[model samples]
Target: MTDNENLKTTPLDSLHRELGGKMVPFAGYAMPVQYPAGILKEHAQTRTQAGLFDVSHMGQARLTGADPATAFETLVPGDIAGLGAGRMRYTMFTNEAGGILDDLMATNMGDHLFLVVNAACKEADFAHIESGLGDRARLEILTDRALLALQGPAAATVLARFAFAAATMPFMSAAEMDIGGISCLVTRSGYTGEDGYEISIPAAEAEKIARLLLAEVEVAPVGLGARDSLRLEAGLCLYGSDIDTQTTPVEAGLTWAIGKRRREEGGFPGADVIIGQIRGGVSRKRVGILPEGRAPARAHTEITDADGSVIGEVTSGGFGPTIERPIAMGYVAVGSSLPGTRVNLVVRGKALPGAVVRMPFVEQRYYRG
Candidate 1:
């Protein structure tokens, strides 16, 4: 537990405490790391049932302009101009050298673009977006908003009870709806690689909405610890850890998020460098790792070859409860990145044998169509 004196508290701060949440400092907020249910059980509950996560600390904003999509494309490589109404695109703000500033979700909200950025990077992200696209549009941060994610196989079943239309939303879709008469902007997506919805509601109504979802037997209140394990198992990147100002999309295994048109036309930031990487290939790449035995490898662990010479380092690693194995993700030499390629992770001065494996150690259950 960090000094809570200067930390920011979310709208449901008290509610979380009452629920027996082990509060900790995360991204400048006093947030729950796990609850009385514990991280292991909470994580298992999410995979088998549903998990409710309070993501209000994340930055939400709207960009309005004569043509928001066209104006916004200048900052990212994604084809925002092609983003359809009610559709969401995962993209990043690349620097002039093609390094990722931050990864974000941009939803086409017809009149404007609604965006969600990482909590830790929100301030810088907002400032960058403003400097890059402000002249072309109006950037308004949603300070009064609270975001909630309900994810798992039973997510739709529970959300549908509040808003029937929620059950019909396909993956990567967003809509403005009234869930149990509570106004919200819902997105049929999640970081857990599970079929779920992210609901953005008024800050004043956050507690009310969270209470409603927790009241359902299918849903359990999940904390940051479980959220981290769940996302890692899904092979999702965490900003500042897996990616940063020094990492490009090509090196991060996120080139897929860069649209085909953007790659061909070469317009966004660092177009020359990124496009070159797309065609010429990168020296190293982000890869999934599976360490043998029970000891879990953690971030910053050195990766080495058969000869014990250093090659790369683990970015995120831990025991994945869903897969019941020690799962990890890291950047390794391209040749050493193939699945089954033997590698070693230096943990606590001891080199642990491991191998490069396909991502999503636990198979993803994202809803399609």
Candidate 2:
């Protein structure tokens, strides 16, 4: 029972409570914030060993049409038609002005396009997809499905037992497989910048598969608290927090997500403005920050120059378990975005020394076959 007005529960809500998880509101879901082992240990465990995350609160859907590629292409700028079946792409739904509506992952499942979108923005994403594609594309929200993420160095080895094909899956590849007799869609991708898999399965079968995964020695249940710090350490953006309608892909350091072809032959919404920013360069760019001391600079903290003149603001910030330091990400004037540049973070009205550093705070160990 969620007391928070905006909170919803995932299929594994009861299971989390049973595991001594600290439940909290995140993206409208009453999800596990952390377990008894705590955030620091959970975050470190995921980096060195393995951690299981209940991401059932995410939105999963199927896009069907006689020409799914054409239907889907209109919604996002990614080269959907060129995507091979059983492959995944990171793309964004852009507004008319070229601002990001939401960042999403789409997998080509041969017959239909499978999509996993942010839970907080799913309603708007679905509505955009439906209204834009109309009868050309049929959007089927997979309400009966639950998603899970197993991340870290040992994730592949543990998952290989059930989904043998996953052991060979390179980054961004996906496949249809059976795990413990349950049909599922498995992708070699994660937000933690670690080698992992995102598994989508029937909601009814989630508890069973989750229990089975947890039984593995290296796989521990990680909660939202660890998830946030992990992604932050990985230098990944949180939609509404790190990025929004006010931020463009170029401004957010996501220029790579924009296709080369799309850059030249603009067609998607906001193409003109995006192309302009790409060519001329954005005034402010997202950069990583390494604080001098232990105090973690949090979101909304002011970033200033040596003279204490405010330049930008922190979007995501936390103490990195793997890096063992305070790290943050925020936009700064282009001239000051270079690595090794001296800056200061204004926290609790004190000017804390910080330096622009290369991200991710920790190296990513993705299995790039």
Candidate 3:
């Protein structure tokens, strides 16, 4: 058997198979890449209704100490200390050179901090946190948990029937709750641009909760393929694809994540370099692209100027199910990052007309209250 054949399986592996899911290797785990409904339908379903995703492969960890906020601030640039209890903040794990190691979500669960990181980079993220915080904080990896995301315009309505507490939770907030008598940590946040919630429950109870959520008329099981296209349409970055260790937050258009206090206080790793970029600007920036033809521009496709000179490359590209056209995102020179700047995408050795456009080819439907 290949090394990937020996990959781990989530608690819902058998359930996925029972649902006619097509399984594939992802982040050292065998996960459902798509269901029989296919990526196109699944993508549209999520935009119109609710879609349930098994994101248990993600890493969940906790940091505890006399003052966990102080320990966390040493590594990340987010305003953790100012974040109220039961609130979540999106932040980045930055290197000393201002490059991003990973992008993650941090939630204050009153006594300790709850963190969810990318599945592929969990080991590096954990080691980095441990070495930086050391004796000041204790790191606990919760490998026994399973994560599920219910996302769409009707997500809140569907989840409201199962858990009353979820109905009251505000955006970017979280709380400990029981779903069908199983204890779980529920957060009003997700990777999709739409308003959604991520529920972290016991591994053994994962299937039960998933089945319950799927039982709802508006909910369907969506897989990785649709998940990627949905996030791309929302203009969210995919780790390793859109942003990586070589990309800085400023270059990725995530400068708003660095709070004013954190930027001026200058205590976190990479503060100098990142702050410098905030003032001096970076060489290139991540922008959205609208291709001319119906043919989708896949990743690594060359981006060129009006005169057909190579300027940059596409990082994430595909057919947008919602827009019904080809769209993409990539890093281009700072001077060519304007919304109306004309550009060309070299596809099959031909330069196709394109233009720099505002991101989120589809409008975001986040529930803000």
Candidate 4:
């Protein structure tokens, strides 16, 4: 556990406090859990309008070399070599045993590849990259920057007011643009599964950019609480909870992230194991779980079958504000992973009826074009 006194603060820390954000320790940083509007209201605000988030705690870095993409592919299973310029791909680093190390975003920025890693795993992730690549690419950690996410249905309109071109960028594409007169690397992507952009800005100007976005009528200052619920409703994985070093991509329902070429011609770490799983299938698979009652199943909640047999456990669970019901994601025996398969959640040592269901409890509203 990170000591509260040693926790770091983001560039938008002051603004968060000014907006009555309730700060809490997260990933070794003092991040806001929610604002005065509360989690429920904030969650609705993002779905209906727009929500601004401070994601500066995430690690940002640049990898540059003669052929960074080809070199990068040596570490992740994603098709980094095939990633087009200004396009982004979501991929993960795996261990020798095929367990996920951490998931990350790799953006092909023309001359170099830009990476955004989870805050909790940055230090070790960077070291792993350096050791694995071994001078094949130069890693430049961008410590003097901040990341902001403007998410929701109205996010495009809110951002368009400052940079009209940003509103037209295709989903998963990135570009260098000026927003409110500050230079930023804007990507039409977000964790909420909404039409939004993740803006990377200079640390010193982060507050200015944040304030400008918040000044918009449809924009509200959101915190980590709503962010979690939003991603959950979207059926996205939360690194430490939904996925971990003990979980493989195949088991986590992320086999889609492994590029076809990489799958056929394996070379990256754990390729042998992951490819084998892809071919033969795995014993367990991640699936969406919808508890029948209002009682929300939480992480580590024991999951059982109708016959009172333990099958798996919930990895992430909560009451989805948008769905207005209890939803969860967990790994179950492959036979029980089918949608509509009846299951039981052992909450408080009592059996609670639930069933397997298709995910994305809320429709992903990304603007594909």
Deviation (Å) of 348 in candidate 3: 1.9
Candidate 3 residue runs with Cα over 4 Å from true position: 1-4
Model with the higher TM-score, candidate 2 or 3: 3
Clashing pairs in 4: none
TM-score of 2: 0.97
TM-score of 1: 0.99
Model 3 clash pairs are none
- Name the best candidate (by lDDT): 4
Model 2: colliding residue pairs:
none
lDDT of 3 by residue, 244-304 (tens): 9889999999998988899899798889999999999999999999998898889999999
Per-model TM-score, in order, reads 0.99, 0.97, 0.98, 0.99
What is the number of residue pairs that collide in model 2?
A: 0
Residue 330 displacement in candidate 1 (angstroms): 0.4
Provide the lDDT at 183 for model 3: 88
Local distance difference test, each candidate = 0.93, 0.91, 0.92, 0.95
Better of 1 and 2 by TM-score: 1
The clash numbers for all candidates, in the given order, read: 0, 0, 0, 0
Candidate 2 lDDT by residue in tens digits, 229-260? 99998899999988899988889888888778
What overall lDDT, based on C-alpha atoms, would model 3 receive against the true structure?
0.92
lDDT of 1 by residue, 107-188 (tens): 9999999999999999998898888876799999999999999999999999999998899898999999897688999999
Preferred candidate (lDDT higher): 1 or 4:
4
Model 2 spans with C-alpha error above 4 angstroms: 1-6
